[model samples]
Target chain A: MITEQHILSAFDRDLESVQAMIMKMGGLVEAALSDAAAALETQDEALAEQVRKGDAAIDALEESVNAECARLIALRGPIAGDLRTVLTVMKIATALERSGDYAKNLAKRALVLGQLAPIPGAAGAIRRLARQVGLLLKDALDAFIARDAGLAEDVRQRDLEVDQMYNALFREFLTFMMEDPRNITACMHLHFIAKNIERVGDHATTIAEQVIYLTTGTLPGGDRPKADLTVEGQ
Target chain B: MITEQHILSAFDRDLESVQAMIMKMGGLVEAALSDAAAALETQDEALAEQVRKGDAAIDALEESVNAECARLIALRGPIAGDLRTVLTVMKIATALERSGDYAKNLAKRALVLGQLAPIPGAAGAIRRLARQVGLLLKDALDAFIARDAGLAEDVRQRDLEVDQMYNALFREFLTFMMEDPRNITACMHLHFIAKNIERVGDHATTIAEQVIYLTTGTLPGGDRPKADLTVEGQ
Candidate 1:
């Protein structure tokens, strides 16, 4: 009993709802990552516990998104653009789920590394990396929400900074382990936590790329690019 | 103008052709990875050249597959299962492309490390790890082609072995670097090459998981609880 106008309106509503849900999920995941990093810095087991508990909510949100995406795909019979949106939502859900997993890993590593006395200044580098990745992740989602190709491209470019920091942190941690063999276990735990954050940055870049692809039929890489890198073009 | 039987036969032919292309691409990528390892071991620019050359063919195959997939999606109103198959093919193509990129990175590293007099005995571990992952990559695709859940599960389990070997190799390379500071660059190259192969193992695991999901409607992991070795997997 639905006309074309009704169908289009319903599709718009569903897309908005789905986007809202994704933002909620992304916020929760970002909090979990930040808390995990904070726990590492402060040796706070309670924050780690919060991160662990937050996974259940992330999982639930993911299941909800999947169900909604499935319903939209089945009902709307969308064209390539809608199809890409639905597919990107599904993929972003999975990416967020994995990011939650990484955050949990970081929390656990924090708890383990906390048992050791302290490594001065190591925690700050991890914190900076986490903050930068968090910004990238937020901007990537913002790009998706606004269909802002320029923002997505910026997010993609930021990934290199995260990688460079990760590499430097890895070497620093390696040096720490070598300097004091007793600190090996703690440093290794930190190494993995840092790696998890770096991977989160990678997933953020992936989401940005997907956004770029979804908006434009062409995938971003190599020349002959279609989208301009400024908000004015968006 | 076409009978149902004829249409079905065309689908079958198209499916087989796509699968053949994917397998061919997979083989070339695996060979390139193996050659990268060999190049690093033997300090052979020739083998590195082969890998770099092979990447062009992989790119060509990927483009062809992308075009065919687009045509099929546009022309054929594939149903749910068939849609899933087409979508999986696209995602699998991406995984294969990334695997090729990793191999290309390995080859580039090999070329750089080759000029600095190859480290003796370091390549064995890299080769062994590459061989294991190569086999896993082949077997994973085989399982996908056959829709054999048992084979897919076996490939999933085999990934653990590659992970173990990678960690062990990492430790050994660390020891080598610690013994001689001059070995640092060469050892880092070996580490990244091993890491690339290990990542290939991971991608194979991801593909196998997708195959399982395509059959069983459930993602991999979280089914049977076991002693989790990796910090991320638990």
Candidate 2:
């Protein structure tokens, strides 16, 4: 009943649909990250509450993406490029979902820290790290959409910068905690939220790697040198 | 030119080959983990060096497993179960590769610490955590090998325990560094290495999740109660 043209067109259609859904998910996550950062800035318990409620939608989206990928792979036997695209989407869904979790983590901590006096811009490192990671996520997804391996490679390089920022931020927190031991728990929570952001960056880098592999049939670690950085979270 | 029987048998052969290779990779990673622990206990830089050297072979093996999966997926056009098997193998290969990376990270740090002074049983926590994660790794692969979702679920539950141990170990290290600033650098390395081991445990949980998904067609996180742990990781 099914013809070859039908299958190819159907594959293309499904790929397009998946890409759109992923971008939508990316948009939601980006907004979540920004909102979480703003929540910390304003110590907005209400916005923090919203982030916790929003996580369920992100989780549902991830599940739906996986289900769609599975259904497509079953109904249509896609070839290398199509297969890679589906797999990449599936992997990115997990990463994006976790990024949402990171945002929620930050929001949760922000709520707790709301009870205390402000540390006078204690959230600066987290904001910078979140923004950097958000850009990486955007660029990685854009590269995938554009099928641009060069853009993907560039995103991979940016991961090192995030890693460096993560360590420096961690060191700064360590110094803060050392200066005031009472800040240990609060700073630790912030450190983990920052770590979650770095991990999101890593996952974006992973998507970039998959894009390069899909396009060129080679992984990027061979001759491509990773940027030198503080080397934490590896 | 390809017969149905040929395709089926080729799929079977390749799947079996991939399983074998995954188990082999798992074994190598376990050895590296154990050797790294031993190096820590005995201040054996030679053993740590050996683990570092052994990682290249694990890397090579992982590459082969990946290539084999790609080849099978391309050539055979495998069906539902066969396809999941190949995909799972690819996923497991990645988890195993990261396990090796963790072992290598531990060994690298052991090399550095061994040069500083005798570690003086600093390897205790690493040894315990490595063994726990190693067991989880083995059980996860076994579940994959036998297609046993039940065993995989058990591994998933056990991951919580490993995480708790890592957290406790981390807190202890944090306290050690807090008590004496001189321990900061060494403790930092130890903390990250422990974090990597804990992550390896989580990756094993992921493999288990894939197993459950492959068999039951349901992802485990929704509506399921969180695993009860005496010492929670987060």
**Candidate maximizing lDDT:** 2
Model 1, stretches more than 4 Å misplaced? A49-71, A115-117, A167-192, A223-234, B1-14, B49-71, B111-120, B174-189, B220-234
Per-residue CA lDDT of model 1 for A36-152, tens digit only, reads 888888878899888987788998898789768766765676666766687778778877877887898788777767677677688888988999988989999999999999999
How well is each residue in A51-150 modelled by candidate 2, as lDDT tens digits?
8779888888988887787677877877677776787787778778867877876777778777655554568768888889889989998998898999
DockQ of 2: 0.26
lDDT of 2 by residue, B158-204 (tens): 98788678767767776766676556556656766787788788778
Pairs of colliding residues, candidate 1: none
lDDT of 2 at A130: 85
Off by over 4 Å in 2: A1-3, A108-120, A221-234, B1-6, B49-56, B112-122, B221-234
Chain B TM-score, one value per candidate, order as shown: 0.90, 0.90
lDDT of 1 by residue, B15-82 (tens): 77888888888888888888877887777888888887788788778777766765565455455666
Instruction: Say which docking band candidate 2 falls in.
Output: acceptable
